[model samples]
Target: MRFDELDSKMRIYETAADYCVLPGMYMVARLDGRSFTRLTKDVCQFEAPFDTGFRDLMAETAENLMTCGFRVWYAYSESDEISLLFDRDEQLFGRKLRKYNSTLAAEASAKFSLLLGHVATFDCRISQLPSENLVVDYFRWRNEDAARNALNAYCYWTLRKTGLDEQQATSRTCGLSVSQKNQLLYEHGLNFNDVPAWQKRGIGLYWEEIEKNAQNPLTGESVMARRRRIKRNFDLPMKDQYDGFIQSFFTRSPSRGIS
Candidate 1:
């Protein structure tokens, strides 16, 4: 057998099962911390329920993903998870799902470990959206989840601070409705609504264009150039208000996608 024939045969085996995302559909790569329960509470000993340090680490990791590769239009992070919305026409790795998933997980794991001063792992998955409406709904769903998680965390930590064991705290919050959880916080002199929006709604990162004036070394002439950079938004809105933000991003960029 010839060497070229053998090499071609081996390459087919590796790529035979590779799956690629639809070219015209929007791609969302969501990365979640693996076994974060043990990592946060047992290993790192983050503040009960929520900690600023851990939150900052997640935010920084999200920022790194935003700038890593692919033109991510929006990045959202909450709890131990981050979701990155890639451009509609992204062709990196030929839109290979395996490439996007493994690379993002690797990047997130590396960045998070460096930020936390300890080893951490993130597992990533890709979501394909057929239209813009699904994209809007997807983020709204995550935002609502952030709200629920925030309420439960505060309630659980308060119970723990008041001497309830882990099992008891879990039992106490189990089956509790949203209003019930808010009331539980209020009874303890904590206002759920007063909690920081970022904690409840998650953090968002996207690109923003700014004008930079540059002087040509040869001509010594001042000229304006448009520069694009990542911008983090911690004060994200909820419900219908957030929908507007999604719509704005979709329209803000010049015809980056088809109709």
Candidate 2:
């Protein structure tokens, strides 16, 4: 067989099962840490329930993903998960699902592992939302999840500190309602409402315009110029307010697709 004919015959096997995101649909890539519970608790030994160092690592990894060659409009991170919202018009790799899944997972895993000095891994998947409202709901879902996880974690760790083993703590919190969990924390003198907003609501990353001082080469004069930067929001709104916040991004002018 000719070289071109042989190459074409083999390539079909690789591309036969490939799927792509359709045009006009919103794409959101969610990357989750693999085996992170053991990685953080047993190997890294990070502070239980929540730790600032681990939080920072997650935030940094999310930010890195935003600038790593994709038109990511927003990023949200909580616990060991990161969610990236891409611009609606994004057509990279002709919207290939496997390309996105593999690249993002590799990028996140590589960035996080380098930062932590350990071999951490992330698995990625893309959610194709058909409407803007669905996109808003998607983020709202994750936002509320953060709150639930935070409350449960605080309650679980508190019980653990009070001599409850893992099984005992999980058993105690299994059937507790939201109010009941809050009461549990109150009984331990830790107010769930007083926890850091970032822990409960997750962190958001988006681009913002800021002015910077620059020097004019011709006249040696200083001038203010505007530039876009990734702004980190540790304090995010909740419920209806959060829905409005995500909706607002859709109405903005098309992004320049910068890193």
Candidate 3:
């Protein structure tokens, strides 16, 4: 057969996609901390309670979670709490929320329990929410709670280090808020006031800004150009802004379907 004839019959482009598709806008994950704290405190007798080593451990743990295949960002709260953000568009992520949660929790429990020689125990819960405004607000509220708890925990640990018993530690730190935490730290020569505020938590900015600078998700024109003649404003990125949109689906469990 001639090369040209063979090439014509091969249908080389039939299986190819015309264009690339980007993934989801964002991914949000939260973990419960009450059990984590109890476990850590029981196991480690470090003077500051949640010392640098513990924090590093949590960071490593977050890195492990990232192995599930998403862009990951994490923050710690109250010595034992954590919040995770994942890229929403990764493959199988939407369907794997439960699997991810259960797997993370189980791994934490087993690893911590074993490493700490039964002195500590961990029980955890995980959840994912849409990255819309309402969900952002929810994340803010949750992180704020974590921040407040962190201040309290630090205060209690400080008092305990200064020779107060557990009861006294809790009592002395009662009613302390983030502002108070700053003042207390300032009194002791520390510069920064508090951890990042809960309101400041999560993915810092929205993708709308990025879309504003680039072509529209649907029409593929400058956003301002379209706005000049008609009053049409579309802020969200094109659904397939990234090639891995399937990961966002992991937030939704198969049993629960869409919520």
- C-alpha RMSD for every candidate: 2.0, 1.6, 15.7
Winner by lDDT between candidate 2 and candidate 1? 2
Order of all candidates by TM-score, from best down to worst? 2, 1, 3
Candidate 1 stretches with Cα past 4 Å from truth are 257-259
Top-scoring candidate (lDDT) = 2
Q: Pick the candidate with the highest TM-score.
A: 2
Provide TM-scores for the models. 0.95, 0.96, 0.50
Predictions in order: lDDT: 0.89, 0.93, 0.46
Where does candidate 1 have its weakest 10-residue lDDT segment?
250-259
Candidate 2 yields a Cα-based lDDT of 0.93
Q: Higher TM-score: candidate 1 or 2?
A: 2
Structural RMSD, model 3 = 15.7
Which TM-score value belongs to model 2?
0.96
- Residue-level lDDT tens digits of model 1 in 200-225: 99999888888999987889999987
